[model samples]
Target: MTDYSKELEIAKQAAQKGSEIIRNYTSNQNFNIELKGKNDLVTDADLETEKVILTHIRNVFPEDQIMAEESAGERRVPEARTWLVDPIDGTTNFAHGFPIYCVSVAMWEHGEPKVGVVLEVGRDQLFTAQKGRGARLNGSLIHISRITDPADSLIGTGFPYRDLHMVEHYLDLFEYLMHNTHGVRRPGSAAYDLCCVAAGYFDGFYEYSLNAWDVAAASLIIQEAGGEISDWEGDDNWLFGKRILAGNKVIHDFLLNAVEEHFTPEERKAEK
Candidate 1:
């Protein structure tokens, strides 16, 4: 078995470095903004933070492949193992100074995420996990909420900002959850949302049209936190299938049932 302590620490430091860069831009508001797509954005913070984080990782593990949002095109090695990075997971939130963005790092050894680290910068919360070592929030062990009943659950989700073709069907699913769960929150960050569910802060989270960089880290953290994660079809293809439903077992299945009913086979596929 691989020892992931060093990997976890490096991922944590990368996130911390990213947090500093994010806070700098948050206060100064002196960054160039780019429209990556309709309603999807990127900022200087995303690029700079990605640079620093990748620099540190390269210094330590030069052989590991990296797939970060801003700089992957500039620096990519053959993939034996890979590092996934979302320098600023909630760019819109960061650009607007909404204070809900984060840095996410995940180490994929072989093909699966072996360690995950996500720091909610504004909140000063660090959520981490190594495969087989239970998930943690700021060094304390965490677990999914045990509320097995659907009606009592608090769910979380994010809208497909880049692709709205399925908006009507997504709304149908959202409306069902709104009337069913205690409440639903679209906090504009998928990494943070997944950690919130892992910490039992929310009972479940589901979303579609997400990049692997957005959920790779948080997915491992959620699993190690005693939570369940899967695609809309209740399968393991979430990373690229573009659909995810995560929570305790009961709540996951409950959400999956709704998703299977609402999203058709074509809608479930990742946007090309």
Candidate 2:
């Protein structure tokens, strides 16, 4: 069995340290921004925060492998423990001085997330989860919203970079959800979106074309907060598949069914 308490402490410390780096850089009057891809962006803050988080993780868990957004070296390390890190979950928002970004850290043991942390830097809100231990925001326990009716629930989602071919399909899904739900929010940060769901700020969240580092940490938070998580197909292996739907139990099944109903044959083939 994994030492989840120790792992959670390490993840919390790493996220807090990374958040400090982000807070310091965000306050600076001038910072450099760069494009990682078409619409995907990076800033000096992202790299600096990654460096700090990796340094801290290595100092305490030197033998563990690392998969990070800014500096991922290899896919597999022939080890039992792997750390997934996203220094800044909402780079575009952070670059534009928006306060919705966060630092996410998760540890995977035997291919499952065992502990996770998502730190909302500007707000100083630290969300954490350990398997079987429950989830917390700041220092208090959190739970998903109890809203059962989709029409009465506020939902959150993300739009992937335009060039990805699924953009149109995603838009269709977004439009459908917008008309069906009370309100829909695109926060540009998957980690923040899931954290919001865990904290009951958003009743549900779904998105396509996300990376493992993007959802690994926040998924644990949602599940531990008495919410449900799954792939677009309503499967549990969301980490590897790059698609996710999360919400409280009452709405999770309903939302998944709605999403499945809209998947065209072509879209299904593309997913495959």
Candidate 3:
């Protein structure tokens, strides 16, 4: 059997170490910044944090494979164990001095996330979850909100910076939700958005075009916190797919139906 408690402890330590490195770099007056794409930003802090995280993970699990945002290596791993690392999930926010970024780390076994950790550096909050175990925030148990009515639920979403064509589809869904739900928020960070849903701060969240490292840790946390997660088609293939929706069971279904209605037959076929 997997020692989930031990794995959680190690992940927590690694995340804390990475958070400290990020915090220190944020105070530097002359930190280097680079643009990976149109709206994707990277900084010295991101690379430094990844170094700290990878070193810690390698020290503990030498043979495990690593899938990280900054690494140029391939993600394929013939072994059963792998680590997903997003040293800084909100690099754009971090570069702009926004406090909504985090260090997300997850361990996968047999192709599923088995251990997850998300450390919000700005707030010093640690969120963790292990397969079969409940989720926690700062060592306190968490659960999804009990809201059932879409009119009273607050939802969250992230827009893809790389693809502008998808923006119209996203906006259509957003417009529908804005009129039906209580409110909607765009936090610009998928990892932080999932953490908020796990903590019951948001009733639901959905987004399109996200990478594995962006949602691997947060998805497990939401699942362990008594929330539901799936792709836009209301399926379980969230890890590899570009679309995701997460919320309490009731709200998740409601959001899924609304999202489906926003896409036309041709749009749906094009997405496929």
Candidate 4:
């Protein structure tokens, strides 16, 4: 097996640098926000942070490909050593000074994630993981919660901001989880929500319409932390599949079954 210690360090460094940029721009209310779609926002902070992260990565691994949120947009997952970056995952939260955003960075080689890092900017909690090494939060080893029952679990999720085609079915699933689980939260950032699952802060998480940069880093962290992640069909296509469900083994299965009961095959196929 190949060692990914150095790549893990690089991901942490890039995420930290990007977090600094996000913090610097947090106090300024006029960071030049624009809309890419009806409810999708892009800000100067997101663009500037992405540039800083990309530059730091390019300086160290100049030949590596990058798919950053503000610059490269979305692309097919390539076989080369590619870095997936989301400079600020929760642009809406940051733009409104809600302070629940993050800087996410991950490297993929041979079509799998090799290293991952996600830094929650508001609290400065850094999560890092390598292919084989266990996941970490601020340098301490972390693992998923052993909560087995959905009724006793706290679930995390995101609302559909850009795409509303599946809103009705999504809300049905949401209401079902609300009545079944201990509680449900929509934290705005999918990356941060997934990391919360990795750190055991959240027992599970699910959402739709998320892009590759949103989950690439956090999904690896979840797996390394002894958790499970997959699309609604329980497949390994969560990265680009537009839907994700994650949790510890038991809670994961519970969520999967809930999804199965709530969503239809036609709705699942619509996302693909």
Best lDDT among the predictions, by candidate number: 4
Alpha-carbon error at 129 in model 1, in Å? 0.4
TM-score of 2: 0.93
> Which residue pairs collide in model 1, if any?
none
lDDT of each residue in 239-261, candidate 1, tens digit only: 86778899999999999888888
Give the runs in model 4 whose Cα sits over 4 Å from its true position.
270-272
RMSD of each: 2.0, 2.0, 1.9, 1.2
Q: Top TM-score: which candidate number?
A: 4
Alpha-carbon TM-score of each model against the true structure? 0.96, 0.93, 0.94, 0.97
Candidate 1: worst-modelled 10 consecutive residues by lDDT:
70-79
**Residue 188 in candidate 2 has what lDDT?**
87
With a 3 Å backbone cut-off (N, CA, C), the pairs that clash in candidate 3 are none
lDDT of 3 by residue, 1-272 (tens): 67777778878999999998998988774579998888878888889899999999899889888898998376343347888989999888888888789999998888888999999988888999999888999999999999999899999998779867667877988889989999899887898899899999999998877888999899999999999999878887677666789999999999889878886644333132
User: How many collisions per candidate?
Assistant: 0, 0, 0, 0
Q: What's the ranking of the predictions by lDDT, best on top?
A: 4, 1, 3, 2
Candidate 4 similarity to native, TM-score: 0.97
Tens digits of per-residue lDDT for model 4, 153-196: 99999999888988888899889988998999988999999999
Instruction: Give per-residue lDDT, candidate 2, residue 205.
Output: 89
